[model samples]
Target: MQIAYLMNTYPVTSATFIRREIAALEAQGVSVRRFAVRPWDQQLVDDADRQEQTRTTYLLAPGGLRLVLLTMAESLRNPRGFWRAAKTAWTLYRNAGRGALVRHVAYLMEAVHLKRLANGCTHVHAHFSTNTAAVALLCARLGGPGYSFTAHGPDEFLDPGAASLGLKLQMARFAVAITEFARVQLALAGGMGIWPKLHVVRCGVDVTDLRPAPPPATDAPFVCVGRLCVQKAQEHIVAALADLHQTHPQARVILIGDGDTRPAITAAIARHGLGEHVELRGWADNAAVKDALSGARALLLPSFAEGLPIVIMEAHALGRPVISTYIAGIPELVDQQTGWLVPAGDVPALAAAMRACMDTPPEELASMGAMARARVEAAHDVTRNATDLKALFSRYV
Candidate 1:
């Protein structure tokens, strides 16, 4: 069967899980077309993402005039479908703020273009319950294939009404939530009656490709893999590392992603005198990330919010423990048995967890890594999740 995958931005360095999902479906003999609102504006460090860029069709890449022309042509060809899509866009504009009326109009234009681009696909699956999903919804209204979206929340749930998340959920053929917490939030927004349409589909990793490495040494540094954003709370990690420095003078952290908060985090590192202890390695390719995880004692991600970070699964797949916060779906995967789970934004608790991980025996850490790997095998295998997703799509196709 042929299907389409859509996202606001495709081939992003941090969102490798989406690529893996599409690859897995292709391996199962499905013809999957890639679509995106736009290409990632920054330089893509990963070779895989660079390759994926060539395969994606960007709605906005051809410029605004092309979108306008497509909207006009599609309206001339199918006025009824165009009106239906426009009415849906108007509802979304009303549900969201009136200030975003232009954005909603742009979504309708994008949907018109995408409908032509994805002519033969049996279904269209979008990655986030945001603008990408809005375009998908409008496309379906314009006589396109059935559409579904995976909700990875924190932003989507923050203001569901403004996001038009409830409307999207109700209109989608089926909606996927990466975690049970996310599914509950979707239910809350869409109301309890739409619960039957919501399904929990965890983001997954390639278990076989991420073979476990030898156990890390006692003096190994902690590796945190994610964007340096406010939600990721990398600043808290810097503060915690400062506190741990007195007890574990040789301790160090290697942050492996870049974002807007880099200057703030840099300032925090300097202010805390953690220039040597906290290192910002910026964005690394998948190989570098795996190497960093392989050499680390534990993965540190004291995020204030998350939708079960795939890096946690990757760290476990590489036989490394994780020291993350107990927020979102993290508590479901991490505990004392796997690694440390500290409270979000609690610098003291985070510092204590880091210290404890540093002080833990190597054998005990290895045992925790074993359990973590087992957890990934059971719940976060990319192949298995893709099969499940294909089954869901098959029902509609």
Candidate 2:
């Protein structure tokens, strides 16, 4: 089957799962074409191009210098793609004569982005609920194959109207949400009868290849992985590290991933005198991060909001229990068996949970870790997820 994968920003350094999922599908002999918005800004263009399988295309819209604007004039304003193009034109016209209007012209570029992906694909699946899905849905409406998308996390789930849910549902044949919570909320936000079409498809991880934790010779190391942003609640993790240090001074804390809040998080570490105990290792790739998770005593993610974060699934697959917040769909994975879930923004509670993990014996922690692996294998296998996608795509066929 021919498939087109759409994302708001492809080659995003932060979200390697996009590439992982595309690789998983192509491995099954499916013809997968990749498309992205704002392509030039991405640094991994070389990585996608070097791939022997799947064809990768960049949707450079109407703004650049010459070609895109002319293409927009022909294809975007074309009858099949008129409504979206008109909306784009209107947005541009509204801001006309101002230099700022030029950027809004990017919307017109969606006409070309969609048209190119629709050419031979049997299905179009976009990631997240930003304008990326808008472009995919717009193309599907203009005689493209059935289109769908996977929505994730805060920006998309927290603010529904930003993605134009009415238009999204009207154009989408199916909608996938990373968490059950996200699925229900998107249904409510869409304000359409298509609520029944929403599906909960948690992003999966490779269960077999994950490395096992070290033998019980060394003291357990606690780690947290994700961008150091507000939603990640790294600050809470820092507070927990302080508590861990006061009691179990032998416990070591390592942080992976980088973002806007690095300075503040680093400053917090200094304020708490956690320099000796805590270390920041920024932006490790999937394999490296998984290796870290494999050896860690626990994977900490005290986030303020989430949509079944892929990291949590990966951690469980690697045999590590997660210590996370109860917000959104987090409770689905973390519960009495696998890990602890505390209220969002509760630093003291998070601190206590960390101490509990540190104080727990190695044999007990290992049993919980084994449960993590079992839970992931039973529910979130990558192949199973792809199989379901094939069945879902058959509807459009």
Task: Return the top candidate by TM-score.
Answer: 1
> What tens-digit string does per-residue lDDT give for candidate 2 at 1-397?
8888877666665676677677777777777788777553533323443352134566664346554755446564566555645564554345333564454456455645566546877888888876677667556544556688888867776555544665576668888887788887787887648777888777777666664565333576778888789989897788887876788788887899888899999999999988887889986666677678877888889988777777888888776878998888888778858888889988889888888887777787778878888878877777777767667777755
Residue 287 CA displacement from its true place in model 2, Å = 2.7
* lDDT (10s digit) by residue, model 1, range 37-146: 99998999988899999999999877999889889999999999999999999999998986898899999999998999999998999999999999999999999998
Tell me the whole-model lDDT of each prediction, alpha carbons only: 0.92, 0.72
Superposition error at 83 for model 2 (Å): 4.7
Task: Give the TM-score comparing model 2 with the true structure, all chains together.
Answer: 0.89
Worst 10 residues of 2 by lDDT: 45-54
**TM-score against native, each model:** 0.98, 0.89
**Local error of candidate 2 at 241, Å?**
1.6
Clashing pairs in 1: none
lDDT minimum window of 10 residues, candidate 1: 388-397
